[model samples]
Target: MSHPHSRRVRRGLIALAAVGGCALTTLVAVPASAAMTGSEKAADPASCPVAAEISQGYHDGHDGVDLAAPLGTPIFAAGPGTVTESGPASGYGQWIRIKHSDGAVTEYGHMNERFVNVGDTVTGGQRIASVGNEGQSTGPHLHFEVHRDGGTGFGDDPLAYMSERGVSLPCTP
Candidate 1:
């Protein structure tokens, strides 16, 4: 029989591949630029950006959607963007913040590892890091957020916004 560790590794690989496939499809379907709203038009999703609903729940501060996934599960870029910031910050443990060409910014926090460095261009659904429980978190999860350019304010609700665009999440608990 195969070793348990080996089996685990094999499963991890399969999971990674599945996640990658989804990201690739999301990138193609969204077409980065065409999916952009007024502000996003300048940036376009083409740079490869997409979001993953890691967990499930609700939070007022989070604008009412909670993504709950296992620790170390792959986290994908919501759309194509540049790694403008990738490091730890107050409240957010290991994190990566990407700036899309469309004057919008996406933040991924509670990361266990950062796969991409600052200044690197990342495509939507690309694996940027593993979900983690770094700072101010109760469990291993990712605190994802999006902000409009010039920091005017957050745009639409991330949960509804992503769903409206055709990205769907598995039922979470």
Candidate 2:
């Protein structure tokens, strides 16, 4: 999409869609990356969103795990869901949020780039974005969070929750 004509056409379509009062959804077909494995099943919150091996961990009151990764490292989805939001959010920087069928919503923040868009269906362990230092981040790492029962805030301890679901966190304290 580096060509000027391509960009112009895209912009023109977007403007036309807006004037028509329609939500412009540009569907992007993404191939599965090597970073992902295993098919999604049951829509359970039992699987790890990121790969099990993490550099950092979780903390008390921290709703998600901070996984240290290099910039542009692909980040995968933890479970099957529909993407609800994917854009810049305060303190989240560039983020992608998915609402799972099991009454849970998961968010991945501080990404350098997002591959999917709103209304995209994502499976567990599917590549969704590339890790980056964005928003309220100190370095290049992914900030992952899960909110239960479709709530927006007041996230529970992801370490304990993941551990109970059989996914271990790197946190010791």
Candidate 3:
């Protein structure tokens, strides 16, 4: 036989579990993404660029992230910035670099076509290029990099940088 105190505790636990289940159901029914407005969608990093999988991530020698997409897939700017460099590059084929107002620089490489040119002011999520198997790449992908000091050196981990900015890389479709 259960004690009175134990019975009360058990009843309370059951009630809490029922309430939690209802809350969980409600949460599952309403996806956060579905509720986002146009402005919020624009600010969403997923909408910023490369809505594909990460073929390669930042590593010791690899200072950028590789987003795998089909050839001709459009690539968008990661943030609002001025195009400082755009055109053929040594190991990047067609490359585009944008210098943001915060002194941070974003680079996109291995593109088949560059829509933006040097000195062009680009907004976040603007189409800047398309994926291609150009230069040193083995397949079609966008090699994306973020430099904190806006220098032509090894960049910091792009995933971390995006995360710090409340952005996530390789957004899913």
Candidate 4:
């Protein structure tokens, strides 16, 4: 039998690891069945982006639709656009920004990895980045923003914008 002190040390170690792991990756718990995906990978949902309910919406000054997805889930470009910004932003971790044909720019934030770069042109539904728990994110998700009138901050509601284009979310924002 192990000493009492050794047992206590083992338990302490396990507890510390658990806390650290939780801090590193916020599991955006969206059930596979509850998420909606327009991509062909629906047959293999594991590779798709499953947007969860907007935990935080525009009204709260969140500025984007928080789509809770698994870490590394591919984030597709919402429309055809030219990549304007790619890489880390203050609170947006590894992010990507695209300027669409409408002169409006969209930003994808908290990405684990980015597939595009500044000045690169991307098509609708093109893979741009993977979901992650970066920046101020409490959980792994894609913080997608739609900025209109060539502005920064105070953008349009991403849910309404994407919904108009036919990308359905599991819950209303």
The total of clashing pairs for model 4 equals 0
Give Cα-based local distance difference scores for all models.
0.61, 0.69, 0.76, 0.67
Per-residue C-alpha lDDT of model 3 across residues 1-173, encoded as one tens digit per residue: 63423422443455566777754333223335323455743553433477778999987678899999999999998888799999999999889998876567988999999999899998887898888989999999999998865755568778866765667776742
My TM-score estimates for the predictions, one after another, are 0.62, 0.66, 0.72, 0.66
What lDDT does model 1 reach? 0.61
Candidate 4, 72-100: lDDT as tens digits: 87788777778999998998778888887
RMSD of each: 15.7, 16.9, 13.9, 17.8
In candidate 2, position 48 carries an lDDT of 55
Off by over 4 Å in 1: 1-43, 46-60, 63-65, 150-156, 169-173
lDDT of 2 by residue, 93-131 (tens): 899988887667888899999999999998776889988
For candidate 4, the per-residue lDDT at 149 reads 45
Evaluate model 2: give its TM-score.
0.66
Output the number of the lDDT-best candidate: 3
Better of 1 and 3 by lDDT: 3
Q: After superposition, how far is residue 9 of candidate 3 from its true place, in Å?
A: 50
Model 4 accuracy (lDDT, Cα): 0.67
Give residue 113's lDDT in candidate 1 (0 to 100).
Answer: 84
True-structure RMSD for candidate 1: 15.7
